[model samples]
Target: MTTPAAADPTPTTGRRAVGGMRALTLATAFAAASGYLVMLVAGRTLGPSDYPLFATYWGAFFALGGVANGLMQETTRAVRSARVGPAAVLPAPGTGGRVRLLPAGLMLGLVLACVVAVSAPAWPRLGLPAFSGVGVAVMAVGILGFSLQAATAGALSGTERWGLYAVLLTVDAALRLGVAGVAWWAGDAGLGFAFATVAGTVTWAVMIALSPATREALTRAVDVGRRRFWRNTASAMLASAGTAALVVGFPVFVTATVRESDPAPLVGAVILAITLTRAPLLVPLTSFQSAIIVYFVQRRELGPRALAGPLGLVTAVGLVGAGAAWL
Candidate 1:
């Protein structure tokens, strides 16, 4: 017979929650620093006009990528939560199920790359300034990298392996810095800065794929319910888009509002201001958002009624943050 749900048998979950918070704190710090570095490096290397354009690349990515991350957060919590049931024994998330998305992720990447390459000429129609064909292609490829990285984050998160998650964040940032440093050296800020993100994420994806745990997760006899997986994926994508609008979609607004040849000094400040203000929310809060999701999921009270109190608090905080960022 299973231990009564009322009796908390595992000290493991409690310990991991505490430890995960620490890792998350560190991860948030790493993400913030690296993101700023990417921005600053591009600014220094690319100069004024190019800076706004590069920022646009990130704006689009993060906004859309939020959905990908949403997928990560929910998947992690759901997968981990499943193991709590005595009969639901399965390979832990980081070990195998993570890579299940790999083939699909790659296909998605390929599709996006083709779209970007094809659309390179019609950028003006998209209202983005015409970038070099290579720059556009690199941008699409970076998006592909981020998709794999985001899913990996979900995998590690599901397993409550905070330390590895922290490493993922730190490594991604550090590698970006290194590659951006190279871009700086090359003095080709535009495409070079784009290269930094692509390189960092590609490597991180490889890192996760090769982990012993991932190997185990794959080789084991697993029971990822087919209907359940697709259902969860659909729900996760919707949540991802909603959450992203709250956080990452700021750039899209900025991109749409500003004219390509507007030549206004305020335009640059607009991008910078949005970034600075959003960082407090996105970097620290959003980066560790899975922790919040997992916490609620574990409690068995994740429904709308249960979430009311916390969501209200988040809304208030978000408003305050927006005002502060605006200032």
Candidate 2:
């Protein structure tokens, strides 16, 4: 009787999990398709001679945004940990000296902005020949805004607000597509497209104003103390930074090193090919990264067994994708 009672909820739990995944899949697919469209617009508008530079700039911004991704991932873990039944849970957020994420995110954003400003003098030589001080300044502002988005995304993911998270993801991709289209229409050049790249970073602001739940999520506390949170964040950032280099920053590296007879078209072709090929694999994995982490955190008692299913799915998908590409 006890075993039967315990097993009764399994079907309902599986159904909920499947529903959440379907929603996430649709959202991420839209985001991925929007990205491909944005690339097409950039390539057509910027033309061959200039598209490579835009691609490189796009890559560089996302590479730096990897730092913000670290914040999001760490915040997700911390928030989830706090909510779970822990032996030493802190006080409810916004009381008893709990440390909220927004204030910390704002401070970090300011620090990142300062770093970008200080590094402005080297912009021209550092694969940013087309960028003036003003461009760098805009990038700094974008980075500051991105920190807010990261914090909000982490908060929503941690709190199991999957509907809102899917909305956030969809809105972000839509903004990018809309802004890039406007930029092309205005003939704003690579600089305008650069702005388009970071346009979605401020989506969190709108989300906060419109959604009371988002505002409330931001107040949630981390599982750890302030010092420990930052320490863990540092480690996460280092690992994410390495990933950013290999994944997003590869175009920039190829731009620098490849010595083709007609390098402009060659580099552009390589960048486009890489982007199109990698998107199918990387986008879904990245979009679901926070959810996967949360799932594992919830099932930590299951040990390594928790990983087998997701790992097998990824492997099977990779094999199918590889075979498709080969044919």
Candidate 3:
């Protein structure tokens, strides 16, 4: 008794979905490759003496940014996805349209700034004070940029435009690598490289600002009122910052504990090795995370079947990769 419409194959839709997944996979791969390249170039060009400072800056920026991103992910996946209205998710209008994220941007910024201050004294030994300043600035910008990017990606996933999201990420990575490469080539070791990050952030911010969907989200966020926005943003910041510390703090600890003869190269090599081990897994991880966010939002239940499959796959892949890296 099925109608012809119901019997249709819808093969086109399937193809489009596959295409989107392919794009996302390619984009993530490229981004990881570019990151690896940047690390290699920085280590080789800057050498051990300068590389530590470079590592410090890189670590701080990514760590803070990761925290900001984590907050954004949680907000998009859990809070906002729960249909909890804009007033509960975004910032107030008078606050320059800044999203009133959990953990409040100011509070998060202050904490990050404090961390930077504590870490600043070590910069001179690495060859530059300006590097420290640039590192802080980059981290702050990255916090904003990464959060926005995650928010946008969340929205896109909701709409199932995974391909577009992937493309944007790829573009962002390409820009970062391109800028950093140019700076490294020009022999502007410290400042130039930092400025490149600034450029990339500006580019990403501008792109997000101009996107209609992002603009709409921002508008909703602005209407969400200061209190609610701050509450959520603050929570997100704390969670994100903690996660960031875990990921980036290790290298700093290693540097501190290790001998001073040539710590930079060692740290850089370890980081590079880690990056390589993780690169291939990123696409799957990203896809899995995105899918999980959507599933949790829609279903309100974290089924074991859903969890087991991805977890097993990720663990198996990670183990194999880790083994290879260790070898």
Candidate 4:
């Protein structure tokens, strides 16, 4: 017979879940707002004539980072499943062997960095006159930094360390905003904004150094073996690449399709409009991906029925958003 106190633990657990959700929501809101502000600052600082250059470069950087984002997603699932035991989707880590995901992600990031560097000479032909070898070098460093961030973020999410996860999200966005603000105040243009775009990738390192829990998360092992992890990561990257093309990379396409004969201000305005209009609807949802994945994984025993509530909520939100847009 279960004691009443034991049976009542669900209430406490529910409360904690609610609290964590609030924290995550606040952190996501801050990130979205900060991103919008960064775009605004970039436009003002770079002005109309040069803003398109920065916009195009920004789009390209994120499109490439989609690969890293894919790593993060799989890491989240792999780590969460490992922690949740054998009943979950992915296999659990064991005494037989453990593969640290961060190191693997870093190696992959290095390979990507090399590829980017080797391809730098071709960037100008793709419409980025400013991205010579130096720009590519900066991008390589940013990719490496982001790979570190993605692995750490996945570990944190898998362990259900929502506090640290929220902090990670908040700090990354805040740092980017601060750097952009500094660039704006200093009157630096496209190059400075490029640095700002990639600046937050170092947040994971700082978090790991300051928080012992973050450091401990780095030790968390994924469920899959190395080869399987890489294969899964490649599939995730392909999906994320498509997402990146539709989301951030749309600006790159828009910039590219605009001929030199097109007016510069018009191009910049269209890019900015697309960014601002779409971000509010998408950024928070994207930021919550790990959390959603974790939620569904925990409830996998409930099967497909578990998705009903979230799907309904998303539908409601989408309808409201569409109506607002129409108005």
Best by lDDT: 4
Per-prediction count of colliding residue pairs? 5, 0, 13, 0
> In what order do the candidates fall by lDDT, top score first?
4, 2, 1, 3
Higher-lDDT candidate of 3 and 4: 4
**TM per prediction:** 0.78, 0.89, 0.71, 0.90
- Candidate 4 lDDT trough over 10 residues, lowest sum: 1-10
TM-score of 1: 0.78
The CA lDDT at 6 in model 2 is: 17
What does the lDDT read for residue 10 in candidate 3? 16
Poorest stretch of ten by lDDT in candidate 3: 1-10
Best of the candidates, TM-score:
4
Question: Could you arrange the candidates by TM-score from highest to lowest?
Answer: 4, 2, 1, 3
Task: Indicate the TM-score of model 2.
Answer: 0.89
User: lDDT tens digits, residues 70-177, model 2?
Assistant: 888988888777665524256444433555788777877888888878877766655677866767877888888888788888888777676677888899899989
* TM-score, candidate number 3: 0.71
Better of 1 and 3 by TM-score: 1
In model 2, residue pairs whose N, Cα or C atoms come closer than 3 Å (at least 3 residues apart or on different chains), thus clashing, are: none
lDDT (Cα) of model 1 = 0.64
Per-residue lDDT for 262 in model 2? 62
